[model samples]
Target: MFFLGCFATATAAAAAAEVAAPVPGYVLDNTEVREIHAASLKRDYQLYVALPDSYRASERRYPVVFVVDAGYAFPVARGIASRLHRHAGMEEAIVVGLSYAKGDEGVYSRRRDYTPSVPRNGGYRSDMPGRPAAFGEADAYGRFIATEVFPHVAAHYRADMRRKIFVGHSYGSLLGLQVLLTRPNTFEHYILGSPSLWFDRGVMFDREKAYAAAHGDMPASVFFGIGSRETLAPGKQRSRAEEDADMVADLRDFHGALAAHRYRGLATTLKVFADEDHASVFPLVLTHGLRAYLKQK
Candidate 1:
């Protein structure tokens, strides 16, 4: 939750901190970094970007992938991007790791910003009154990204907006769905890992069904994944087994609904990792999802 880097100049300081030798075949370097106080959310956020070696030599623009909850996931994503670059010479990408303000406040800040709407009578529903109070302002948050964040990154760096990809986990997953449904073309590809689909009593599934029935072709590539261990034990020991089951059920249903659409222009796949828990599956999900996206591209 610390500032990965404050200004772009800090990149050099970070690189120097790790002056020790590199690890065998692997290499490390700090790319450009930026921090912003998003007016919509009223909180500062950090972006950690990693560039491939070839990026320095080429004048060509590259695709950009926004990874939500980047405080923890950035390392995993950096590894994936490097491996793909070294082995397959895959097209380079600008990897941005999204982070909110530091400490416990960040957790609550993400919960408020990432969530869409609160359910009136659902297990996860907040005790707060009205949808806006509990779920915060999802529409405003999305607008901030579309208007402020995306444009800032595009203008400051060599990013290909046409090939934009979004990767989100849990509540961030809900934000991805909200964007996909409301602004279908915002992101060309979506990597949603362990989406909190049970939010608002499966509201996203309802939205997806309606969109499928009304629309013809949805042009997007989506990769969905959930850990095989996405469950809770039914007993006095566990907090809420029923709630866990309901969440997993909703995720599967949403996955099935997207499959049913069979939208010709849309390519989507879902994976479940037997050994992974909700928190641990992110690395694997990013690894395989990026591979799939590269292949499709």
Candidate 2:
């Protein structure tokens, strides 16, 4: 009788354990939310800020990485940051994720806040168009980061000003490139993944070339990455292969422009992940980029 009771108890415990296990690849948890209106877009952003495990253990200020398109990228960033700290001897950096708010506001809000300009065709083009007038607010977004956002983060967190980085993918990368072109040193480092270079007829690449021609010296560290499968997405009114080829060509031109600057102070790296697609490549990018970025420190 006692053996039967013990067996029943073990069975129930095993069932409980199975029920309590977390789903695979489920890493994010709802922590906090904040609203910031900048770049002329009313944004209710979901913020996922992760500190190093040793942050509180030892009072130390670390670098910060601002992540755009946080909905999909934050978990990847967090995981990469933690792993890098453990295995690669990378310094712990604070991650600030910025995501669009819910409801009718989010669709148009990110597009306007992250893009450089609205194309003449009345479409953002790189991204499926949403609200037309609200597009091309990247400059204002930079202002928000430099003024409102950075100050708030600096005051609240232990962050080093000179070692900060801005990370973005797709339209977000378009904004990162815009900041690098005009602002130059807003963030000491930039991690751009799969930037939408087809937007507005590749004006961003043109701006890079013009900047290289005009400037005598440029100083910044940029890490550019693209997934091999990013070109697989079906396009509207355009051939997928043509779009991919254009994007790849523009990216190559942009990288060449940066390289052509040959400014002794400028350092940049471009990488392509052949196995991962646009949605699946960010984690690897963050891991490799962070390891490289920390090598300087």
Candidate 3:
């Protein structure tokens, strides 16, 4: 009886050990990973590049879409791009996923890199991994993308510089706006999804005002979308009228301002996805937003 009990215990332990072991990493088809040293940001970034199916057969240059928050969104973006090209009749493009270094401390780099202005009270909430601190380094992040990332992609791949697109969600969308307003020509098209325009009590509105005052015209194409249910109150919470995070209203105000400004040579579109919340709106944006911005002109 004692010997049988010992054998049973040993077998269970072995099984548990086998179950807990880490599985091998799987590679995505048509995707490659590259690490680039960004001097401006003083860190290394991992880029997940997804090439189009026809890339190897043709000499034609392809449009490139840079997807922020690549750690989570890279595979989704690549899959959407491929599907759209294959069935939806949209133009094929190269998809690039921007990610941070492995085992990064605190994991606050996304919040630091994506926000334009810090909260006045010195703290903010972030969807990324880590508690937020006083962080507003979008300028430095933009510099890294333009100087280091863009150059590297252009040199290695046949990317069309004039047809570049940028896609971002939530805080990532806010970063895209900073790039659009400050460096207008960095990318020809911008797809901003559920931007956190309420951050810092609408600091981005002031940015728009400054841009209008300094420049007579802005030249770019922009597409913005938000969830219809984003304005709804959270579980057992107060209504949007009483909430501070009314994203729907903020997005409407931003879009209104852009339309009112009527900056020369600028094209803009806004869409609200019905029955979708903040977190559920990204895949729709990835599909429809790509088609809206990447349509041949």
Best by TM-score: 3
Clash list (residue pairs), candidate 1:
none
User: Candidate 3: lDDT over CA atoms?
Assistant: 0.85
TM-score of each candidate?
0.78, 0.79, 0.86
Q: How far is candidate 2 from the true structure (C-alpha RMSD, Å)?
A: 6.3
How many clashing residue pairs are found in candidate 1? Answer: 0
Per-residue lDDT for 1-297 in model 3, tens only?
999999999999999999999999888988888889988767888899999999999999999999999988889999999888888778899999999645454347777888897766554455455644537888889889999999999998989878889999998998999998999888888989999887776789899999988887779889898899988466644222224567887888889988888899889888999999988999888787788777643
Deviation in Å, model 3, residue 197 alpha carbon = 0.6
lDDT (tens digit, per residue) of candidate 2 on 1-297: 999999999999999999999878644542334556553445444556777777777778889888887877776787788778787677777888877645535547677878898665563333334534568888887777887788777887788888888898888898898898888789888898888887776778678778777886667888988877665446644322335444544566788877877865678998888887767887777766777687532
What's the residue-level lDDT of 239 in candidate 1?
26
Count clashing residue pairs in model 2: 0
Could you tell me the TM-score of candidate 2? 0.79
Off by over 4 Å in 1: 1-28, 40-43, 101-104, 122-134, 232-242, 246-248, 295-297
